[model samples]
Target chain A: MNTADIKNEKSVRYHGVGISNGCVSGPLRFFRQRRKMGRIRACGDQREERARFEQALLRTREQLDTLQRRAIREIGKKEAEIFEIHAMMLEDEDFLEAVQGALDDGACAETAVERAAEKHAQALRSLGDPYLSARAEDLHDVATQLLRQLSGERPDGDLSTEREPYILVADDLSPSETVTMEKSMILGFVTFGGTPNSHTSILARAMGIPALVGVGAVSEDCDGAYALLDAAEGTLTVSPDAEERCAFEEKQREVNDLAREHDRYLRSLINKPAITRSGRKILIYANVGEGREIAQALLNGADGVGLLRSEFLYLSMDRYPTEDELFASYHDVVQSMQGKRIVIRTLDIGADKQIPYFALPQEENPALGFRGVRICLAREEIFKTQLRAILRASAYGNVSVMVPMIVSEDEVRACRVILNECMEELEREGKKFDHGIEFGIMIETPAAAIMSDEIAREVDFFSVGTNDLTQYTLAADRQNPLVERICEENREPILRLIEMAAEAIHRHDGWIGICGELAADLHLTQRFIDLGIDELSVSVPYLLGVREKVTECK
Target chain B: MKEFTYTIEDPNGMHARPAGKLATYAKQFDADIRVHAGEKESDGKRLLALMSLGATCGTELHFIISGSDEEAACEQLERFCRESWGRGE
Candidate 1:
């Protein structure tokens, strides 16, 4: 259908599966522009095919640049830069030569691009680095998207024209495409494929959309069926009975009203401490992973950054971030916080999170294997680089360095030794810093929690990583759905660990921060308050909710 | 021309709200306001450029202003640095 034809339609239904959260309602728009793909005859000579392949590559490069510029204009500069990386992929001589080789075998330009993308994707997957492997998926998606754009076929599907707010169903939406959707028009999202860790899901959650992912065939059944979606419950009903529709509508309204009321209350309490009626005070902090998150955390009323995941800086790069790169990143966070507290967790890469560039050995039981503080112990160079970066950043603002996955006092001491060494190195260089820059340990392992008293003596504070703690305490693999029920955040054992850790740290005159998904739990906010957690570090979006909960508890 | 050296005491450096606020302040005066860290210089009235400078806390920066109201621009920026950008104030 032509753009005008689709735009003029009053209402239409194009169905797929929902993958992420949130609802948007707006005019149905379709991005149907395709990239032009040059065809090569099957009997073409190697030289002829090679020339055609090069021409196609040049055209693809131009198309990518144009898309990238449009992306920059539509989104922000940072997001647009993601496309630049893809453009770099197109320019890789080795990759281009491989595609040319395929085209010389009598493959069309489209087939050659697809074949090359698949080969590179498999190679990346075999590398076994999640982030690097994920990049392979990104490369594959981008190449396919670019090829399709060149082939005169739209990779993105048509948007419906129905005025009524409806959920978008898709196989999976890329982060870039998800951002392009008008927020006003999307009612919600349902996808057949996508994990919570996917960037699209993260963005949807950030956008506050109710999303249900992995609902196998719901999208096909819901086609043109005026559906009702309960995102909180991860339920989608296609053509529900009248009563169910009425009930869902009422529930949606109630949720909207409550959200509005909560927003107003949070605005009123922005400048106020999260104190209960009984004068109990709780500090609300942000769990930041990157520099961008620091600004978001501050805007959401975070008094400081509770957990700055340092892995992002090391990932997606060719080598260890130079001290200058590290300094610049940390400086960005410190400057953005405007002097608010920033607790940075040193590189926590291990089994589950790997940096292919580092080439760490793959372990059978990665969870209990070489990771966290253990990895740092063996790879002192990587650890020291991070320490130096954090230390140099400390010279900038209220920055504290924390070691993750600590299991014993010795690990704490060893980390402290390296940190001090780095600090001493800086001191010898005549660099000034908060000599008393606070050092902390992530109490993820049960052994660390049990030995909190001893660890506390060596550090300034403790931050309980509830996500890992729950998994370890329950002896349940978090990724295993069979034991999902046992991994409940509000379970008795998890709460007790938090209570115990907080008490132990408090006895030593040390503070404790919780930087887990549990920190954002509305139901557990009061419990955290009661446990006397010095800081509740949550995702930025949950800051207001946490602030209100803290205030109401007071 | 007026130049002053200051440390970025505000956490998160000169980004987001602070950068926007500083940009607004810069536009109020008829000065050629520029912020420099090492070799990087940014338009003091543009938040994007200022943020790209990545000036974080404890990083020494030079605020250079020239033309009319140069003194006012320097004074305002200096005050922001010294007072911790009014965060939690």
Candidate 2:
């Protein structure tokens, strides 16, 4: 009844996941593309058929080159790579060979290009790799470009005519097409199908244009109608009445004011240390998995890296990496850190992170089965190799070694013994390493949190990995939606455990840090500060926000 | 023929960008450059062929250059891979 009333009096609404927080009221414009073409009745002449195919290729190349140059001028070279890839696809020997074979079989130029591109695209679709499978669309994109050129369809004849700003809508958009759009006239984008992680959404957010994606299809009849798109609210109210537009305009202004306020406040806290009113200072650190993200973390003013997963080294490899490979990778990251502490976690694989070479057995419950420190403990050589590499990398910067899924004191003792053995071996080999590198363990298990005093006595520090602590504490899997509320309602229990662990660690003169999902929770930032966490390590984007919150705390 | 092995160090590893760059670079040489990753071999001058190799980060890319200017192609391309594509870190 409420839905019916809202639809009747104000507008009909379409919902989607919003990428940016702004809102705009503008005319809606759906992207239209020509797909079906009249079949060409080719003469039984092989030479002319081949010439036609060749001409289409040349025209497509010139168009792509123009798009590439424009993209470089407007969006930069990185985005222009999309067109470069298309150009290469247009000239690929395999693709050309397929087209030539089709031409030899007396098919027309359009039929040959379509058949060849479809064959390759079908092969790619069956590859089962989501990333590689997406390339099938790129093939179709290039093929469509060639077909349009072959049919003498003029490009850019209509885009110049849309002078007024409109919220563009599409089923999907290639990166090149999105980059080449006139930015000044684009109010926003509303895609019928796109994830926030898609290149289109990322580009939209980077351009500071609000976008509503994964909204299902908007009817063709709704085109040119005035729609108020509230991206923060993830609602598109088509044909909105004056009252609804006024409400949305007021909401947009308030949202913009809040963002402006946050921006100004965050800038002030950038270089300054986040100190509470009681003179307690909190360290803002970043959790990263890849080396490329380190640059962004430092750019965002992270004091240090709290949790460098160190699994990227393992994940990137076709096989187990040699000690030198591991050391060289870590050395690059360590040097780039420029003396800031990088807490390198040892191989935390086994459960969901299994390599084929490891031959880990499938379990009924993989999360509860052999994982993290358990895998490292059973595979001591892999553990020692990582420890040796991290210790060696410590020569360049303030590097710390952290262990994950550690639930017992014995695991800590075993890891320390192996670390000590590795250190002695490195010393015996006349290799350089930092002798006093700090060692820490993730307090993720409820058992570890309860046994914090004993665990704290053995380790230099404790970083609460709240993600797993919440999972194990609540006995709920994060991937399961049925028990999501059970996990949410029981967050206080996890915080209480963190409090207990913090007290125990502080008693032992060991500083505590939170490096899990909870670390970025601004609402719980004060609660974390009250619990005596000396450091809060979040992802790159949350660094300043957490720092800003800390400064406002008592 | 001149052949050498270099491990791919870029995190994205032989994806579209690097593969396109590799293809474009190889097309400039008179020599035929064939790159092998694991069991898969690809025409270095072809983007789709190189991407089909699926050489991920840490996967060794073995390059074999043969024909006229093989020595120069081998020398320059090896240098390019080492300097530009050597380390994702």
What DockQ do you compute for every candidate structure?
0.01, 0.13
Q: What is the per-residue lDDT of model 2 for residues A105-171, given as tens digits with 9 covering 90 to 100?
A: 8888888888998888776656554555566678878888887878887533245468799998887
DockQ of 1: 0.01
lDDT of 1 by residue, A139-221 (tens): 66567665654454544455634466656766656654665465545667766555554445655555666666655533243
lDDT of 2 at A351: 47
TM-score of each: 0.56, 0.54
Please provide the root mean square deviation of candidate 2 (C-alpha atoms, Å). 20.2
**Which has the greatest DockQ?**
2
Q: Cα lDDT of all candidates, in order?
A: 0.70, 0.82
By summed lDDT, which 10 consecutive residues of candidate 1 chain A come out lowest?
A1-10
Q: After superposition, how far is residue A283 of candidate 1 from its true place, in Å?
A: 0.8
Q: Pairs clashing in candidate 2?
A: none
Q: Given candidate 2, what's the lDDT at residue A339? A: 91
